[model samples]
Target: MTLIRSLAAALLLACALPASADIFKCTDPISGKVTYTNTKIGEKGCTLLSKDQNVSAVPANGAKKPAASPTDFPKVDNSTQRARDNDRRKILETELASEERALESAKKELAEQESMRSGGERNFSRVQERVKPFQDQVELHERNVEAIRAEIAKLR
Candidate 1:
C-alpha cells in the first residue's frame, strides 16, 4: 500500500506542474516519515484528483512525510458517522437499563419505609438515611438518561 501510494503520488506530482498546483504533504505509512508535496494527490487513494499525467511536482527539501490518512483525503458517505451513532446507542441502552433498575430499587425502598411507618415504627430519621442515598441515585440516573436521550435524538 505504501509503495503504491508513493508511486501514485510521484506520478501525480509528475503530472502536477511546478508553479500551478499547491504542494500537499503526504507520507509513507510503513515509515513515519513526512512527505512534502506541491500537489493535492494520493490522499484519496490517488483517484479523486484526475489532473493530466504530463506535469510534475517541484522537488522537496529534506523533510520526511507521514502516511496520508482518510482525513488527508475526503469521502462522501455516512459510514463513519453511522458507526459512531450505533456505538452511542449501545452505550445509552446499557445506561438506561441501569437507571431503570436503580429506579425500581429506590421505589421499593421508599415503599418499605412507608410500610414501616404504618406498622407503628415512627423513627423517621433512620428511614430517611436509608432512602436518601437511593433517592439521589435514582435522580442521578434520570438526569443522565435524559441527557443521553437528548444527544441520541440529535444523531437522528
Candidate 2:
C-alpha cells in the first residue's frame, strides 16, 4: 500500500505537483490502467487542473511509466567492470598465496609427524587442516577467475 503511494508521490513530485492535485480516478482496461489527467477521461496526457478543478483531482503522469525497468539504463563495456574484478582478483590471489603457504607447511608437518611424534599420534590433524584451507583457496581462485572471464566476455 505504501509502495503504491510512494510511486504516486514520486510521479507527482517529478511533475511538480500542486497540493490540491491529489486525487486519482483509475480504472483497469484489458490493455492496462487508463489514468485520467482530471476527473474526466478526455485528456490524453497530464493536463494541469485549475485550483478549483484540482482541489480533489487525481494527478496525471503520477503513474510510473510502463516498460520502466533496470535494463533500460545505459550499458557499459567489460573493461569498466573488469577493473573492479581485477581488484578483487588481486586480493583473492594474495589470499590464495597465503593459503598455499599454509597448506605446504601443513603437509610438511604431517609428513614429519610420522617420524617425530609418539607412535599413537597419527599426524592426521595437520593434513586435515591442509585439505580444508587449500580447498577453500582453490574455490576462491576458481570463482574469481570465472568472474574475470565473465567481465571480459561482456566487453566482446
Candidate 3:
C-alpha cells in the first residue's frame, strides 16, 4: 500500500511540473533569413532566443476538461480512403511497368550499338561519338526506372 501511494504521489508531481522547451534563433548574414530550432545554437552568429515553459492549471476536482470537437473539419470514410489508396497503387504500378519496359529497350539498344562499332571507326573520338548517345539513353532509362520504383514504394 505504501509503495502504491508513493508511486501515485510521484506521478502527480510529474504531471504538475511545467513543460519547457529551449528555442534557438539563427540568421544567415548573406540571405537575411531567420530560422528557429529546438537545439542549442553552435554557430558563432546564432543566438539563444528563449526558453518557453507551458503551464496548465489543474481544476479543484483534479479532473481534465472535455475537449470541444470541431465540426468544420473534413473527414473521409474508410471505404473512400481504401479506394483512393487502391487507385494510387494502380497508377504507380502502371508507371513502374512502363519504366521497366523502357529500361529493357534501352539496354537492348545499347547492346546493339556496342556490337555495331566497326573496325573502320578505329579513332577514339569516332568511337566516343558513336557510343555517347546510346550510353545517355541507357542512363536516362535507368534513372526513370529508379524514380518510378521510389514512387511505388512511397504509395500506401
The whole-model C-alpha lDDT of candidate 3 against the native structure comes to 0.78
Task: Tell me the lDDT of candidate 2.
Answer: 0.56
Cα error, residue 64 of model 2, in Å, equals 29
Per-residue accuracy of model 2 over 1-156 as CA lDDT, tens digit each: 346879997787678754554334555444556564435554443344443443433334466456555966887798988887787667656665665665566556555643454554467786555456655655665665555455445442
**What TM-score should be assigned to candidate 1?**
0.41
| lDDT (Cα, 0-100) at 154 in candidate 2 | 49
Would you estimate the TM-scores of all the predictions?
0.41, 0.30, 0.51
Task: Please give the distance, in angstroms, between residue 132's alpha carbon in candidate 3 and its true position after superposition.
Answer: 1.2
TM-score of candidate 3 versus the correct structure, residues matched by position: 0.51
> Could you give candidate 1's per-residue lDDT for residues 1-156 as a string of tens digits?
346879997887567544454435556666656654545545542222333333343335655466577765866469887887889888877877877787787778767755654443366786676668767766876776677677667666
lDDT, residue 91, candidate 1: 84
> Whose lDDT is greatest here?
3
Angstrom error of the Cα, residue 24, model 3: value is 14
Q: How many pairs of residues collide in each model? A: 15, 3, 0
Model 3, clash count?
0
**What 10-residue stretch in candidate 2 is worst by lDDT?**
51-60
